[model samples]
Target: MNKARIAAAPSPAGLAFRLVFAAAAILLALLSLPQAGHAQGIVRGAQEGSYEGNRIAGPVGGAVGGVVGAGVGGAVGAVEGVLGIPHRHYRHRCHGYYDGYHRFHCYR
Candidate 1:
């Protein structure tokens, strides 16, 4: 009777294949992250988050907005979700621009 070995070492080719697959998987995961994160930004922005990481207020007042709109807004707010709703002016009357500090500045 012959029995298969469950703890046998993998062949060089098999090991290489597994390593390549793992690397590819990791790379794809990393690459997809930014795209996914950008989508989230558009959402938080549409929801009246800061405009490009700026802490400016939205249609609602700053002191009144609280934790709801805590992300960047404006052009970043133009991104539509999977539902494809028009969010161009989701930030309301807010405008966005780069500040002298090389950071995004958004406000009414």
Candidate 2:
């Protein structure tokens, strides 16, 4: 029974493989750090801008919009990071209306 158990146990090569696989997995996880806020913001902004521009105009407009959007997004992201403000989510609702002077008002 003991000999049978020993034969059934994993071989040294199998153990080495498992260790190498685990190490590789750990290394990959470590390498894939979360993107910075500004980077994410910029990417999102550029994509949105490009889409809108393409819908409204042509390729030239899309390019221009992408550049402008990226700049704005980067600035906003930087400010949010500095202020320690979390990213906004659509789940939150705000009640608002336009006032008499064409100014918008919001209440949460």
Candidate 3:
């Protein structure tokens, strides 16, 4: 094997492979630097829940909504069960009464 000839003529495939690997490594490093600066730090409060390491209102709101929804759902289910109809079978309406007089608006 002649070292001079091998050194003088580098394979195109080898050159292309090195270039692609180098580019990928540099791209990854550049992408990660911004993320390091923008690092999310933990936040603590009287109302303490962490979202991305920071305190957020999501869990509290979700819990409240879940409890309220369950109550409403139970009420609706009970009403349906008593009426001998499935939950979807019932139609709903809204009415405003005036001076203790009942006004009915039909909605189907």
Candidate 4:
């Protein structure tokens, strides 16, 4: 059969079915994210806790503590990712970087 014949075979119902399935799949993926990130929430909660602690721990200590804590958390997560250590403590998003001529998001 020619391509046109194959293309014309399905009716509107088929098209609607495909669209609904696609949408449901997308919704499922989107809904799964927060549940997936519940582990990351622990790290985020810790970050907030330290931030609050810093306020009480004194200005100098707080600033130092917050920076060190966040940095260590991110770095440790990155290393664990490389080493295949299963964790969900932090979520990392890669924003595109720019050189004079280029921009890229490295996540994908």
Q: Which candidate wins on lDDT? A: 2
Clashing pairs in 4: none
Q: Using alpha carbons, what is the TM-score of model 2?
A: 0.49
Worst 10 residues of 4 by lDDT: 33-42
Which model, 1 or 3, shows the larger TM-score?
1
Q: Provide the clashing-pair count of each candidate structure.
A: 7, 0, 0, 0
Candidate scoring better on lDDT of 2 and 3: 2
Query: Which residue runs does candidate 4 get wrong by more than 4 Å?
Result: 1-10, 35-58, 67-108
RMSD of 4: 17.2
Tell me model 2's lDDT, rounded to 2 decimals.
0.81
lDDT for each candidate structure: 0.54, 0.81, 0.48, 0.64
Please give the distance, in angstroms, between residue 86's alpha carbon in candidate 4 and its true position after superposition.
14
Candidate 1 Cα outliers beyond 4 Å, as residue runs:
1-8, 35-64, 71-108
| Deviation from truth (RMSD, Å), model 1 | 12.9
Best by TM-score: 2
TM-score of each: 0.38, 0.49, 0.29, 0.33
Clashes of 2: 0
The alpha-carbon deviation from the true structure for residue 50 of candidate 1, after best TM-score superposition, in angstroms, is 8.7
Better of 1 and 4 by TM-score: 1
Please give the ranking of all candidate structures by lDDT, highest first, separated by commas. Answer: 2, 4, 1, 3
Task: Give per-residue CA lDDT, model 2, range 1-108, as digits (tens).
Answer: 455443577689999999999999999998765456447878988998888887888898899889988898888887776677998675425678778997667885
